[model samples]
Target: MKNKLLKITTNLWFDTQAEEAARFYTSIFENSKIGRTTYYGKAGREIHGMSEETVMTIEFELEGQTFVALNGGPHFKFTEAISFIIHCESQEDVDYYWEKLSQGGDEKAQACGWLKDQFGVSWQIIPENITDMINDTDPDRSARVMTALYQMKKIDINTLKLAYNE
Candidate 1:
């Protein structure tokens, strides 16, 4: 068989709970689906030292990004260096994702609408206009917006605009 090129894939390591995490992620996203669940067993077993019913790997897609979750049994934990940033158009959108991701997890709001979810995933629920404010032609306005963003956990666009005008 010829090897065919495919889409981008990110592998996530979990401690015997990859399937569970995949399900949770699929549930949260709108355009998402579970692709395959591979188990261990038999001579053609996909996973080593595991039974046929044991979850070995899971394939899932979120917003068109493919990801594989491997149940490697907790050799590692998620760190803050890599994270998913969600751009929000409004406060409602921000609240929805923030509430859902923060479930059963810790929360730390960073300046400029960035937050760390319970799973140690960093997310930025920034407003659409943030870019415009930051890239404003007026240096004073841009500086003000930057200052406002530095003091906020969840960005408020109106407040940012007001600051930019100052």
Candidate 2:
């Protein structure tokens, strides 16, 4: 049977590191893999400025989500406006992702569980039960959780729990 196309797939634009980024992402996530890769040809040399046979696009998957990394040149860059969130069940899980994703990243951009990775991609490392805490019927408890959340960078689950209970 043929594979069905995903209704929605994320496409990342890179100056020239599509393949590299794909490799890095796949390596970090389990059940991830690098898929097909297409190279540039002389057909669009004038517009793209990339040489023939250079990597044009790379297809990759992270935890089953499909993404395409395009070497579309320096016309664009990643920004904090778009970020992938990783929900963790424990502090250990949060810590692991925070450490790995934040390596060689912008330290100054770290705030409220959001971080920009080395590839300039923003990511949110948060607790799995964050929604429940924030959706509590008691506004005071939810407000407390938000207050505690704002003061964190990597997101301490224990602290959030404490705030919610108080």
Candidate 3:
């Protein structure tokens, strides 16, 4: 074995719906595509104790991130601890993603301008200036922004700024 790795990969465990999930996700993102779906043949069945031609794994890419969706049976579930945050420069971007990702999942407001989509995925729909405002030297302004963020499900950058001025 060589002490070298080409790319970082994330393995997602699905409950016999890896192929379906992969297609759904690829449709949502622009630069997304389903790479390949390998099936387990009879030989694989003997080794893994499963039926032949079943979906063993699926590879897909979303926003340049390569992910492998494994139909490894439902042993685990997704949690908010690990989430993909999409930074938005405008309200349109926020609306586009929020509407799509929130489908068929629960929605929850998170502190400091974040939202959890239907699939238990946490997304921080943040504005470009949010980073600067949060890092500002004024503690009062920062506190105001934090307070404003807590009052809403979807982040409104303009509202947060107004709170900071107050």
Q: Comparing candidate 1 with candidate 2, which one achieves the higher TM-score?
A: 2
Candidate 2 lDDT (Cα, whole model)? 0.93
Q: Residue 118 in model 2: shift from native, Å?
A: 0.8
Residue 108 miss distance in model 3 (angstroms): 4.6
Q: What TM-score does candidate 3 get on C-alpha atoms? A: 0.83
Candidate 3 pairs with clashing backbones:
105-118, 106-118
Q: After superposition on all CA atoms, what RMSD does each candidate show versus the true structure?
A: 3.7, 2.6, 2.9
C-alpha lDDT of all candidate models, in order: 0.77, 0.93, 0.76
TM-score of 1: 0.79
lDDT of 3 by residue, 1-166 (tens): 5987688998887767888878877888898999988887777565566567889899999999999988776668777777777777887787777677767766444555565654455666678778787777999888888778777777776798798788
Which pairs, if any, clash in model 2?
none
C-alpha RMSD (angstroms) for model 3? 2.9
Candidate 2 on 1-166: residue-level lDDT in tens?
4797647889999999899899989888888999999999989788889999999999999988999999998889899999999988899999989998999999999998999999899999988999999999999999999999989888999999999988
Among these predictions, the greatest lDDT belongs to: 2
Please identify model 3 stretches exceeding 4 Å from their true place.
1-6, 43-50, 108-118
